[model samples]
Target: MAYARRLWEGYRELLASEEAYDPFLLLEAVEEWPVFVRALRRAASKNPAEALRLAKEVWREEVPLRVLGVRLPATKEAFLAQVGLA
Candidate 1:
């Protein structure tokens, strides 16, 4: 699985527990927000604080460093060489 997907799955799992999810605030959150996309549900089983922090992180507004994970093809010259075009 992709690292991002794994991270997100972990975040979801962590938030399911009472020790992590803020029922009060969670209920108030807008489901349509983009913040939901950044969530991660992973944490050490014994660390509730970190779990809550991760949840809050998913709730907050922050610019992401990555929007997509892609492996681009080689440069034009490399492609041409491979195809005998050079």
Candidate 2:
């Protein structure tokens, strides 16, 4: 989990920088975890903008773990319910 957090921080930093970032690097950092990749894809499919916002919140530890524990490959309804949006 610490390693994942560090990767997320690095990814965030790259995005914040003025220089162009590598998509492959970001993919490598994130795509190694199939569960996370699935959850992210699901979130993005539902709402791209919100998914990006949530990614930032996740890195900041602003989102509660309970909300995040909706289960990997979660149904849209399940995801919404855990986040109190259903």
Candidate 3:
């Protein structure tokens, strides 16, 4: 979990610092971590729009409740509404 947190922080930092960073560069760093790689691929398989909404929530430091699991909004507008930004 600590490693994952560090990776997430590094990812955000890289995005903030680079105008045109290559995601593949990050991928190479985690190639040996199959569990992390699998989870990443699973998230990547999700609908892009919904994924973006969830990402927006995280980026805004408003991560959704995780009592059972995350319940992603069906649309961007719904996400905004849930976050009280609509």
- Each candidate's root-mean-square deviation in Å? 17.0, 11.4, 12.3
lDDT of 2 by residue, 1-86 (tens): 33334544654564456765466755564454445445655666667666655554553432322232322223545544443334
The per-candidate count of clashes, in order, stands at 6, 0, 0
| Model 1 poorest ten-residue lDDT run | 63-72
Question: What is the model-wide C-alpha lDDT for candidate 3?
Answer: 0.44
Model 3 clash pairs are: none
TM-score of each: 0.23, 0.33, 0.30
Question: What is the Cα-based TM-score of model 2?
Answer: 0.33
CA-lDDT, candidates in order: 0.35, 0.48, 0.44
What is candidate 1's lDDT per residue for 1-86, written digit by digit as tens?
13334554544454454464555434433231233333322232334455445434433312221112111124534422322223
TM-score of 3: 0.30
The alpha-carbon lDDT assigned to residue 44 of candidate 2 equals: 64
lDDT order of candidates, best first? 2, 3, 1
Tens-place lDDT digits, model 3, residues 1-86 = 33434444554464455365455754543453344333433453554454344446444532322211334456756654443444
Best by TM-score: 2
Which residue segments of model 2 deviate by more than 4 Å? 33-56, 59-86
Candidate with maximal lDDT: 2
